[model samples]
Target: MRPPFPTPTAEDIRLVSAQLGRLARDVIGIPARCVCGAPTVVATAPRLADGTPFPTLYYLTHPAATAAISELEATQVMNEFSQVLAEDEAMQAAYLLAHETYIADRESILLVPELEGISAGGMPVRVKCLHALAGHSLSVGPGINPIGDLALARCSWTPTVCQCLVYDA
Candidate 1:
């Protein structure tokens, strides 16, 4: 069993979102107009012990500015992470292992990033982060608008699933 919750504060989300946005602007070279178009902001998201955000399911409200941030930042984050995996063989293997586990246990699993670990109590643990879909239209929850269903569809991944398994309990 896991701790069943996320630990990132609203402030942490703000910090990471800001940092990531800066990374996207500086390192990734996405235009400020595009990056800042929707005014990126942070919210409580899940991550793993090594400080990687969880890629699990996320909820979005209709036409929320967060969706734009979610779309751009999510892709940027994954691309950045992909580079890391390309540079480190161990990281690549770890990513594969995590991906395998995720596919094998897709039912109980939501999002599965490599940062998860076992706690001192022998339960699973992960850093808290937000989730967002990149490419297609989805009928997620109530009142979540269809702003970027096409963007989500354009992502390399289909099914476009995202969620965070941890809870505040």
Candidate 2:
């Protein structure tokens, strides 16, 4: 089982801010971290402090993971996954359930009327963004997101290993 979600510490916020290249807003918790202790996925508030409706619940914050997923997307992997979604009924059902679970998880934090029923990574129907799916997968752990698990498996990077974690000496 995955560890309990951790409240972001001041140091965590600093690392996340550096990772994002800006100050992150409305981050509720760090749901997934690298073996080296850098945050890979963050559970954000449904609504930002400025009252913007943010639909992405689990945001990928690690630069290496983000870059790896982006590379996967560039290789037309999403198209392949979309085809899989079309051909595999069982996978489709599971992916749809993943979408629903994502929505429910976000709503449990804070309900945003405009953001209801919309999960990130083009879930349920299409494979839009591997980064988002991978983020969701890492946050929730394996088996919950099939396509996400597949994407992560196909990628050069894996959350099980820490690829990048810079510490100040």
Candidate 3:
């Protein structure tokens, strides 16, 4: 059977490693890409080969994108987003739904009992990691993950523009 997402080519993995400055692990597919076709988000296995239950399904791999999101996180924007989630019932419901969607997407690949109900980036209650949330937004597109969408909007990096040294495989 075919995978749910596009399997990464060897060069895609190499680009991700260069972007991360380390080897990318258990990346089953490239779920999101830049307009120039470089991988923006990688779909990883729910459980690693080492028997670890990995909760992060959509991982941001673009260097510029990750760096921008990291800078945003350093600004303590999550506190403000958490406040929004707290004040807006619609935002809370949408975030909760995003959490559920993330879980379902992961379990569609592999069901890891240990990571049950644990979605990345502090979803359903608060915002924590903009990188992870933005990765999700990039993977699934806008409207699904509101905080992720907001993070993407606030960050300087954009997948619409090619910001990589090498985007072609």
lDDT per prediction?
0.31, 0.86, 0.87
lDDT of 3 by residue, 1-169 (tens): 1138867899889888777788888999998888888788888899999999899999998888888998988888889999999999999999999999999999998889999899999987878888888888888889999999999999899878888775333
TM-score of each: 0.25, 0.93, 0.94
lDDT of 2 by residue, 12-93 (tens): 8888888888887888899888988888888888898998999988999998899898888889988889999999999999
Report clash pairs, candidate 2. none
Candidate number achieving the greatest lDDT relative to the actual structure: 3
Q: Quote the lDDT for 2 in model 1.
A: 17
The alpha-carbon lDDT assigned to residue 108 of candidate 2 equals: 75
Model 2's alpha-carbon lDDT is 0.86
Span of 10 residues, lowest total lDDT, candidate 2: 1-10
Ranked by TM-score, the better of candidates 2 and 3 is 3
Better of 1 and 2 by lDDT: 2
Residue-pair clash count for candidate 3: 0
Q: Tell me the lDDT of model 3 at 102.
A: 93
